[model samples]
Target chain A: MELAQRILVVIRFECRRGMILSRVATALVLAVFPLALVLLVRTQGGDLETGPRGPGILFALLPGLTCLMCLLLWAIPAIHSEVEGSTWPYLAVRPGGKSAVLLGKYLTAVAWTTAVGWLGVSLCAMTMRLSDRLETWCVLGILILLSALAYGALFVLLGVVFLRRAMVLAVGYAFIMEFLTGFIPAVIHRFTIQYHLRSLLSQWTGWTPASLGGAFHQLSLFSPWPAWGHLLALLGGTAALLAAAGCILRQRELIKPESE
Target chain B: MDGPAGTMILLEHVTKLYGTVIGVNDLTASLPQGAYGLVGPNGSGKSTLLNLLTGQLRPTLGRIAVLGQPPWNNARLCQRLGVCPEQDAFYPNITPLEWVRYLLELQGFSGSEASERAEAALEQVGLAETRRRPLGECSRGMRQRAKLAQALAHDPSLLILDEPFAAVDPLGRRRMVELIRRRIAEGKGVVIASHLLHEVEAVTDRFLLICGGRLLASGTAEEVYALLEELPKEVRLRADQPRRLARQLLETELADAVRLTGRDELVVSTDSPGRLYRQLPQLVDRAGVRVFELRAAEGSLQALFDALLRIHRGMKILQPRD
Candidate 1:
C-alpha cells in the first residue's frame, strides 16, 4: 500500500511536470503531421486507391513515425531528465522510491506516447476515408497502442541503462533494428519491434501483393504469424522490458560519476 | 539518550571504493540517539560517509545498520531516515510547498497531513513567506533552507544532512543551528556533516573528524584538544607594554619562547598553557603591563586538525626509521 502511494506521488509529479504547454503543442503538431502529409499527397493527384505506396505511407506515418517520435520525445527522456538535472539522488533515496519512480515515469511515457500516437493514427485514418472500414481502424488503433507500449518500454530501458547517451543510442537502434532489419525475410528480423508491428499490420490489414504493389515481392518479407502470437509477443515484451528497467534501476547507484 | 542498545547508527569496518579511488576506508563507529556533527574538509570522505549511513551508497566491504536495519533497498528503514543532500539541484520550477508536499506524500503521508507537515516544516525553516515562489528564483540560502524543510517535513527518526550550512549567511546559519538544537531537544537524532568546524560545533559537541578517507578523531573539541597535550600551545596577548610583558613571560619561565608580533602584541609559546594562564596576572602586574586582549592563537579547530595531521604524518615518517 505504501509503495502504491509512493508510485502515485511519482506519477502525479511526473504528469504535472510534463504538462508544459509548448511541449504539448509540439506533440499535438506531431500528431497531426502525418495526416497533413497524407492529405498533401492525395491533393497532388497521388491516386490513393491505385497507388502501391498508399498503405506503406500510411503504415509509416501512423505506427512507424508516430511511435518513434513519441518514444524519443517522451519515454527516452523520462529518466534522462532526472540524471541530467541531478535530482536522481533525492528520489532514489526514498523507500521503494527508485522502482516507484521508474514505474511511474514509465507509465507517464506510455500514456503520453499512446495518446499522441492514437490521435495521429485516428486523424490519419479519418482523413483517408478509412474510418468506414471499422475493423481496419480498430486494428490500426491497437497497433498504434501496442507500438507505443513496446517502444516506450524499450526507450525507458535504454534511458536507465545509459543515462546521458540514451537518446543517440535509441535513435540508432530504431534506425538499424526497427527500420532496416524489420523487413528482412530472415528470422533475425523477428527480434525487432517493427517486424512484429508490420506482421500484425499485414495480417490485420490483409495487405496482399496487389495492395502492397511490387514492393512486397521485392522485400520478400516473411508472412506474419497469427495475430494472437504477435499480440502476446508484444505484450510480453513490454512487461519484460519494463521489469528489466526496474531491476537495473534498483540495483544501480544513482550517483553520477562526473559529479562525484 | 544512550539507552541499553538504542544505537541509531552502526558502521562496522565499512569501506566504500569509487572505482580506483577510495571514498571511505575501514570506517567503524556506533552512535546513539542524539545530535552528532561529522566534520571534515572538502574531499575528506565526509559526504561519502554520510551517503553510506543514509544507505544511498552500499559499502564495498562491511555493513551498516541504521535504526536496527540495513539501509540498502530497505524501505522500512528508509521510512525513518531523512537526508538533505549537498547537491544544489532540485525541482527548480516547482515551489517549495509543492516539492515538499510531494516528497512527504511519497513517505506515505495523506494529502492533508502532507500539506500540513510541509507547511510547518517550511515555517520552521523561516520560508513561510516565499514558500510558494519557484525554487529557481530563491536565493542559494533560501534553497538550502527549502531543502532542509523537505528533509524535516517527513519527521524521520534520524536526519542525515550533508553540508547543511553551505551557502547560508551567518544569521541563516544561526537560525539553522537553533532549528537543529530544537530538533535535538525534541529527542530526535541527527547526523549533520559539514566542511566547516565552527558550523558543526555550533550545533553539537559530539563530532567525528575525518580526512584522507580515514577517521582522524571523534569526540568533543575539548577531548580532541586533550589528545594534543604534548604539542606546545601559543597564546597571543596585546598589552600596552608588549616588550615588558614578553620580558616578564620569559623571566617567569612561564613560556618556552616569547616574541613581539607587533608594537603592542606579544606571542608567547608555552608547553604548559595552564601554568602560563595561572601566572599571567602576576607576570603582567610585575612588568606594569596592561593587557588589552589575550587569546589562544592555536586553539581553533583548523589548528587542531593541522596539528593532528602533522602528528599523523610524523608517525608515518618515524615508522620506517624505527
Candidate 2:
C-alpha cells in the first residue's frame, strides 16, 4: 500500500481509540480550560475590551498553552506508549510500518490539539465582548493550527529520540526554547516556534508592540518579516522536523529489550 | 544481494548486542523451506533471533536474510513474512476483528479484502465467535489466538512465532498445533520458538537447539537424541532380590556400576542401555528376580540439552563403544 494510505489507517484507529471515556473527558477538559480562564477573568470584572491584554491572553491561552499541553499529552508519548504496551512489534513488522505509525500519530495529535484549540478559542470569542472579536477569532484559529503542526512534529521527534523520558524532555524543551528563548529579543529567539507565532500574531491582528509597551515592543523588531515569512518558517520547520524524525526512526532499532 | 534460492532464512555470524549485554552471539545458520522448531530455555535468545528475522531488530554485527532478502528495513521482504511476537498486548478498546483488519490494511490489502481475510483467519484459529469482542475482554488464550490470527491473516509464506502456545490451554494447543501442521502441509515455511520441547516436537521434527545466545545443535529429533546415547545412562530397577540382580548384571558385564538404593531397589549405570534392555529379562530369570519397575533416569529432551551445553562449554562427553 501507499504510505499515505497506511498512515490513514493508523489515524482512523487512533482516533477511534481516542474516543474512550477517559480520553474524551481529558480532551473536553483541555478544550474548556481557556474558556474557563476567560470566564473567571470576566466574572472578576477584568476589562478585556481595552489594551493588549485580551489578544495577548487569547493568543497565550489558545495557541500557546493549549497546543503545547495537548501535544505533550498525545504526541510526546507516541512511540513510548506503543513500546510500553508491547504493541510496537506488531506495527514495526509491516512494510513502512514504523514511518506510517509515526506520521499517522503525528497527524492525529495535530488534529486533536487543533480541534481542541479551535473549540476553546470559539467559546472564548463568543463570551468576550471585543471590538474586533471576529478578527481575533480568525487570527487565533490560524495560529492554533500552526502551533499544533509545529509542536506536534517537535514532540514526535523528541518521543522518537528519547523513548523513555520523552515527556520530560519535551517539557524541558518547551520551557527553554519556546518559552524562555522565544521571549528574548535576540537572534536565537528566531529559531523557536513561538517566535514566528508571536510575530504572526502581532503582524496579522494589528496588535502593535507599542500597545503592550516596553520589553514586548522589542519582539516586533526582532521579527520584522511579513506574515508569509512567518508562515513559511513554521510550515518549513514542521516538515524538516518530521523528516528528521522519520530518518531517525528508520535508522534506530526501536525493539523492546530482550526479556530472554 | 539476494540469498541463495530455497533458503528460508540465512544468518552469517549475526550478533546482536544490547548495550554491554549480548542477545545473539555469532549465530550462523542456513535453513531450508520447511518447518523448524527453535528450542531454548529462558534467556536463550530465541526471541532475539526471531526479531532479527522479522526485521524488528538489526544485528549489531554480521548479516541476516529472510525470504531471499535482508530483513532489516526491507519492506518488500516483509510482505512475504509474518511474525507473531511473544508479547501479548493489544489495543484494549478495539475488537479482534478491527485489530486484525488494521494490520492487514497496513500490509497493503484493501479494506474489503482485509476484512474478509481477517474473518477467515480468525475462524481458522477457532476465534470466530469471539472475533467481534474487545481484545481486553478476551481471555489470554483467546488473545494468543488473536495474535496467531493476525499473523496468519496475511498468509505470508514464512511465519515466525515466538512462544505461540504460552497461554493456550491443552485443547487450544492441540488446535494450534494442527493449524500449524496444516500450514506446513501447504508448503509454507514456519519457525516456532518455544521453551517446551514436546510442544515443538509435536509440530516439527527439525530442531535447532540454542543456549546462552549460541547455536548448540540443529537436526531432527532422533539426531539430537543420538547425541544423548553417547553419555552414560542410569536405569532404576525396583525388584525383589535386588542384590542378586545387581550381581548378575555386573558379572555379565551388562552393567558398569550398580548401587542399592533400598532393600528391593538398585540403580544401574550402563554405557549400553539397548543391550541391557535386551538381556535384562534373561538376567532376571537367571537370578529369579521379580522385577516391579524399570525406567531410564535421564531420557528427556532437557537431558539432551544439558549434555549439549556441557559439550559446548568444552566439558568432556562420553563416547559410545564401536
Candidate 3:
C-alpha cells in the first residue's frame, strides 16, 4: 500500500475511535461558543455596526480563536496520547508508521476543527442579521479552514518536539506570537498565522482602517499583498511545519521509558 | 542488509546502561534460525535484550544485528519481525478485530486483505468466537491472545515474545505452546523470554540462561542438565530399616552422608550418584534392608541454574569424589 493509503486507514479508524462522549461534548461546545457569544451581544442590545463589536470583527476572531483552541485539544497531544496509552510501539513498528500516524492525526485535527469552526461562524452570522450574510459566511468558512490547517500543523510539530509538555508550550506560543505579537503593526507580525488570517479577513471583507476603530484597524497597514498571497502563506506554512514534524519524528526515539 | 546466512541474531559485546544502572551487561551471543528460550529472573535484562533485538533501544556499546541488519529505525527489517511486548496495554474501547485490522493496515495491507488476515490470525489464536468483544472487558488471557494475534497477523519470519504466557491459565498456555510449536515447525524462528522454565521448555529445547544481565550458559536442555552431574545431588529413599540401610551405605562409602529422616526413610547426599545407584541394591541386600522408594531431588534446570549462579559468584560448590 502507498503511504497515503495507510494514512487514510489511520484517519478512518481514529475518527471513528474519537467519537466518545467527552470528545463529542467538546466538539459541541466549540461549535456553540460563537453562537452563544453572538446571542449574548444581541440580548444586551450592543451595537452590531462596523466597530469593535461588529459582525466583521466578531467573525474574524471566531475562526482564529476557535480553531486554535480546537487544535490544542486534538493535535497538541497526538504522540503523547499514544505513548501514555502504551499503544505507540505497535504503531511505531509498522512501515512508515510514525509518519502515517502523525499525518493522519494532523489531518483529522484539521478536519474536525474546521468543521466546528464553520458551524460556529455560520450560526453566528445567522443570529446577527448581517447585511452581507452570505459573504460573511463564505469568508469565515475559508478562514476557519486555513486556520485549522495552519494551527493543526503547528501544534502537531510542537507535540513531536515536546511530548509531555506540548500543550503548555503551544498555549504559550499562541499567547505570545498570535495573540500579542500578531496585532503589532511591524514586519514581525507577518510571521504569525494570526497576522495572515487577519489580513485575509480585512482584504476579503473590505473592512478598512478608518471604518473599524480600535487596534483592529491597525492590521490593515501591515498587510500589503492580495488576498491570495495570505492564502498561499497559510497553506505553505502548514506544509512546511508538517514536513518538519515528520523529519523530527523519524529521527527521534519517542519510546516510553523502560520502567513503564 | 542481510546478515550472515542462517544467523537469526548476532550480538557482539552488547551492553545497555540506563543512567547509572546496567540493564544488559557486556553480552555476546550468535544464534541461528530456530526456536530458543531466553530464561532469566525478573530484572535480569531479558526484556532489555529483546528490546535491542526489536530496535526499540540502542546499545550503549557494541553491535546487534537481527536477520542480517541493524534493527534501529529499520522499517524493512521490521516487516520481517513481529514482537509481542510485555506491556499489556491496548485501546480499551475498540474490539480485538478492529485493533488487529488497524495494525495490519499499518503493515501496508489493503482494507479487505487486512480484515481477512486479522480474522484468520485471531482464529488461529483461538479468539474467533470473542474477537469482536471489547478488549478492555476481555479476560487477561483473552487480551493476551489479542496481543499475539496482532503480532502474528503480519506473518513475519521471526517472532519475539516477552512473557507471552504471563497472565494465561494452563489451558491457554498449552494452546500458546502449540501455536508457537507450529510456527517453529514451519521453519519460522521464535525467541521467547520468560522466567518460567517449564513454560519455555515445553516449546523449545534450546535455552539461554541469563542472570545479572550476563549470559551464564546457552545450549540444548540436555547440555544444561549435564552440568548438574558435576555438582552434588541429594537422593531420598524409603526403606524397611532406615538406620540399617544408612549405616550400610555409609560403611560402603557409596553415600557421602546419610540421615535417617523417619522410621523408614532416609536422605543421602552424594558426590558420585552413578556409583551410588549402581551399588545401592548390593549395599541394601547386604544389610538386609528393603528399599521401597528412591528419587533424585537435584536434577532439574532450577538446580542447574542455582549451581551456575553459585559458580558465577566464585563460590566453591563442586564436590571431589574419593
Pick the DockQ winner.
Answer: 2
Best by TM-score: 2
lDDT of 3 by residue, B135-172 (tens): 88999899899889999998999999988998888887
lDDT of each: 0.80, 0.88, 0.84
- Please give, for residues A4-61, the per-residue lDDT of candidate 1 as tens digits: 7788888888878777787799889988988888788779986453343445566777
Model 1: runs farther than 4 Å from truth? A47-55, A131-133, A208-210, A218-224, A257-260, B1-4, B169-172, B237-255, B260-266, B270-294, B309-322
**TM-scores for candidates 1 onward, in order:** 0.89, 0.93, 0.89
Clashes per model (N, Cα, C within 3 A): 0, 0, 1
* Candidate 1 residue lDDT tens string, B5-100: 988888888898889889888887888888898887788788888777777788999888888788888888778888898887567678899888
lDDT per residue for candidate 2 within A130-235, as digits (tens), equals: 6688899999999999999999999999999998989999999999988888877788889999889988988888776678678765554347798899999999
Q: Highest lDDT: give the candidate number.
A: 2
Tens-digit lDDT track of model 2 for B1-322: 4567899889999999999888988988889899999998888889999989998789999999888888989999889888899998778999999999999999999999999999999999999999989998999999999999999999999999999998899998899999999999999999999999888988999989888888888878777776676567899999988988999999999999999999889999999887888899988887888999997897787777777877877834333233
* Candidate 1 i-RMS: 1.6
Kindly give the stretch of ten consecutive residues in candidate 2 chain A with the minimal lDDT sum: A215-224
In angstroms, give how far residue B27 of model 2 lies from its true place: 1.4
